[model samples]
Target: MLDAMLPVILLLILLYVGYTLVYKTDEPKKERKIHEDTQEVKEKHVEKPKKHVAKRKNPVETTAPKKQIQAEHPLLVHVLKGHTSAITACAFSPNGRFIATASTDRTVRLTLRESLKSKNPTFKTINLPYDYATACSFSSDGKTLGVVTADGCKVSLYSKFKTKPECITTFPVEHNVLSLLLNDIGEEWMTTLTIGKDDNTEIKCWNTSGHLLQTVNVNQIQNYHGVQSLDNRFIAVAAYTPEVKIFEIQRAKDGSFSKLNKAMGLQGHTSGVTDIAFDGSDFKPVNHIVTSSKDGSIRVWDINVRYKLQEDPKCIKQFQAPSGYYSTVDITPDGKWIAMTQGSALYFLKVATMQICCEIQNAQDDDITRIQFDATGIEIFVQGTTSRIIKVYHLPIE
Candidate 1:
């Protein structure tokens, strides 16, 4: 009986040990599942804030569309943009029906003023094969176009420039031509040359046939500018000297150009003169001439004096630029306003008061090369050294 009881006790003890081992193993798996569930909840909580942060940034991103609209100038009327390279010179026809432009791209373009606002503005291109044009002018009748070339210093005349273009003649000049202007009848043209090998500034007159009619030396080092009166009687030149020299262009008995004689000198500025302009295109006796100088002053002279009687030209009004020198100046066709350029800025002054009426700062991207008014004086055209586009502005004179 004792042996049978010992076997039973041993079996019971083995069964209890097996049950305890199974229960302990099942408890740890439950604890691991609870820990994994808590970690998943925490991860979901962290992702919600990231989505909220992205939603909060939507308002700031909506403001970027405002920059798409560019502001345009109030006075700007038209922007002519067909030149492929920098424009060197530009001029309006005498009648204001056409505009002529010369560019470094070795092409001269003629455009109608009426078609400037069209979608495809028509441009008649005149190719310069040998060199580029440095300056250009129109005949009094607006039928002939005169262009000055850079290489060889040549003057080219074009006939029927309005419809069919023809290069009638191109002649070599003696000196480096600074500016060229055709007379009222278009038979003769005048050019101002820089200091020549003879150490003189030369003002030369030539007929369309390329014959040198007359040459006058200004006894100066550099010839900066030259312009003729509308009546074709007087030529005013600015040079390295402060005094502006006025010359009378003599004509032959048939009204053809013959020679030029020194008339008088305008003396006032302290430094070299940079540019000069006549008052208007129609002058009964040419009463006034405007000049700009390195001395930073624009002087209006009463040129109607009797210089033959040895009466000196008088400076009636003097306007000093706020800073820097004026590179170019032009009086309106009505002689009511004076337009000038200093650096890249443009200014308009009332002729009566000599006060600045309007100022357009940064009118060009670079130095302003030329500023001109239309025949009607209602529009102003501006060209720049590096900017390829020509700007046309409607003057708010009223």
Candidate 2:
């Protein structure tokens, strides 16, 4: 009986061991988990293409950065060549139909804007009474022309609309005229003149008839370029010492105007301030002044804050140029763009962001003496000083 009981107990123990091996193990669950993980990876791969398609639908998001990149190659529309010597100054007619260029060759040429390349274009060529015709400007109606010369400190007035200018009158200045600007209406003008080979310069205000209205001594600052505001309410002079002197145009109740007094001084440039421009004001308030310097910097000043801080007028915007020595600067009529010259290159900057819209490298062989934008801001005229080449460029529209 003991042997039989031992055999039965052994058989029961074997059956228990077999049941534990078949049902108590976790291998199937582990295999199912691995298969689920592999399915999740496959689902991820299926969703990736949908995300890529979403990105492809919005190409503008990728292409928007291209707008900020300036044009590497500038489109040159025309090159004008008629001057015998270096072109000293240039001005665009208010109507945008003509351009007046003065040169050291003792000649002032009025070239038709539409036909800059025509050999027999509609133009008026006049010989200056002196060898150096330093600067020239046109009246608002495009009826009168004003020219300043280095010899005898002479300021000559001429009438337009003819094949040749008819001398209206000549005014004598006390010093060599360096810069001249006429008001928008042409009722008044402003000038900066040097004093007898000295570094001393004076700022003068004159009427359209060549009568001196007021004068201020700017000898301390070496002011070389002066411009009147669009409303003729202020005069700004760019100093070689890297400063801008602004004077308010005051009017008395007695119907007489008073002499200019220093209203504000803008100082930021590390080198000489080469050129200055004001807001063109198309029924909008003129509140800013733009300046370029020889130190390769440009600044925009707020006139409202200038009155409060005359010693150091506040600059709202500042930009470092790609190169040094900006010779000239001009703002568009709508205050949208700034056309500036750095060496022989011409640059157009968007006014809002100060980002370069486009640049024309090697625009000429020599330095650019002047740059002016048309009333519509669709065209720009650039003149190389010693190169004696005038270039016309069509501004890119957004």
Candidate 3:
């Protein structure tokens, strides 16, 4: 009886053990499957918000390019292209009807100002015989165009420049011309020439017939940069020195250039001056002059004082450049704005407030060589050392 009881109890215990093993193993698997499904649902919910957020950003990304276009529209007006090489110099006609550009391509192009926007703009190309043109200027009457060549150091005058351009005269220069200017009467011109191998400079006055009237030796001021006043009465020279000298173009009763008298010296800049510009208004004599220097300062000088009385010219205001040396500067014809270049950037400052009104970075492909305003002050012409294009920008400020 005891053995039979033992066998039954053992069978019951075996059955209970089999039930526990099978049920407990399947319960955890079901729990794990449910947890995995919950996690997958949570992941999908998280991705849905991410997709919604991305869709919400689509409009903002689409509008970004429009903002860039609006910012660029007001600054750039026209890009005059034709030269194959770097542009050396550019000048606007006195009447603002034409623009003359000299380039390393050994050609001078006179383009109609109004035709710049048209495809295949109307232009007159004057092929130079020598190397390249270094400087250019227009007579006050806007009837003649003067260009200086580098190889033979010659000055060529062009008459009927607007239509059928003709080289009227080509005269050999004594030295390399750094700057050239034609008098208001168009009968005479002046040039700043580099003398010898010493980097010294001199100013030479000449008649349109190829005769040198007088030579003013400015050897003391090495590396001379000069600009003529609108009235053609004075020349402001910057000589890689802190002081800028003003020379008066003394004329005889017959209206011929007699001599250049040193009128006064502007003493303010701590370093060498780089460029100079006059107000260029219709005033009889230019009273205000702007100078830029390596010291990173642009100075406005009041030259209306009595300099013969030993009075120094007063610096009415001075503004600092953003960085690097100021390569060139120009004041608008209306005297409302001053434009300057530092490296590849162009800055426009309001004359009345002395504040920067606009700044365009990387304005040129290379270092900017020159910056000038049109006769009406509505457009500005900019050129670089290596860029073949002449960029004409509209003044955005009033």
Candidate 4:
């Protein structure tokens, strides 16, 4: 009788528990208590309002890092390696503190510009991609960047940040923009005078707002490519061939561009033109134009005579590029010296005698492609074939 009673009691307890759970549910999910400050956003539950939550933002928000990898200019500074393709052009910032390089790698780089015999000032390197960037330049203010593309008919302006640059606008080009320039005032800009496949040599002038202001047509097709001057009074047209043709730029009352006169024409190089730069007009008496050619020669033109379209410049001087294939040529802003490249070797020539004043014996090497000076003309920067560091050279400012 006891054993039977024990079994009966266990069965009754199990049945009671099952009935309580299965048939006696207390409340629906709607009656469940919720947190007072909880909220939902994009499938995420927030226990506190956005104002109460700590906001996360970087004080120095970095932009998309350009695809190239390299440190800024180093103390031993081997700074830039260009794409495997030929690097086209390079420029220094207006303040003489930064360097910008353009290459066929479809990207450009901005780095601190430095110059020293054995110790280079440190600088940061950051790549900027413009897809097919053929060349890049900084305005006189160092605030805007102008990019020349290979296959495009426009010059792209990028607003430069401390770490990178942002594309501000694209100035539609009349021809393939072999080069782009900003005037001294930073108000006007000039594009390349290119010989189009259609047998036209046109230069499209524009303002910062992307408004087309004027178009000047020349007689034949040519590439006035390389360095351009921003003097509101003169336009330097570095010809596709080894010739330097200059024009007088007169801003008419209507704010249009018109050639006042063919101010100068220089012809001395046997090979194609490589690069050309002008010293400051404030240089002693007359300004000078320094040019480099593929034939490994650097020439200086005295822009003292205002020539007609077909005439020649009155005074000119020439120098031999270091014994190698010359790739680039540049001049300091104050018009004191010239810098040109032959492979990885860089040569600095004095403006007065055009003598080799200084040489970075190994700037780029046979693998090196381009070189340029800072706006203040104290340092030399280089671009190498697949080298992150082109090369940095600091010369004693004489």
Backbone clashes in candidate 4 total 16
Q: What are the TM-scores, per candidate, against the unseen true structure? A: 0.81, 0.71, 0.78, 0.62
Off by over 4 Å in 2: 1-74, 117-119, 162-164, 184-198, 208-211, 252-256, 281-284, 305-313, 322-325
TM-score of 2: 0.71
Model 1 stretches astray by more than 4 angstroms: 1-70, 186-200, 283-285
For model 4, state the Cα shift of residue 217 in Å: 5.2
**Could you tell me the lDDT of residue 271 within candidate 4?**
66
lDDT of 4 by residue, 206-264 (tens): 76666765676644346545344544456665555665666666655655554435566
lDDT of 3 by residue, 194-305 (tens): 2221364777777777787777776555754667777776777777678888888777776666777889989889998888888765444577889999999999988888
lDDT of each: 0.80, 0.72, 0.80, 0.60
How much is 236 displaced in model 3, in angstroms? 1.3
Q: Kindly give the stretch of ten consecutive residues in candidate 4 with the minimal lDDT sum.
A: 190-199
Q: Which stretches of candidate 3 lie over 4 Å from their true place?
A: 1-73, 186-198, 282-285
lDDT of 1 at 344: 86
Q: Mind giving the per-residue lDDT tens digits that candidate 1 earns over 1-398?
A: 98979999999999999999998998899889999999998987785543334345576677665567556667788787888999988888877788899999899999888888899877788999968988888765677788888887888888675676899888877777777877754444333222232244777777667777667788878777777776667888888889899988776676766667888999989999988887666434467888999999999988888888999989999899878899988877667788899888888888899999888888777889788887677888899987888888877676
Residue 293 of model 2: what lDDT?
88
Give the TM-score comparing model 4 with the true structure, all chains together.
0.62
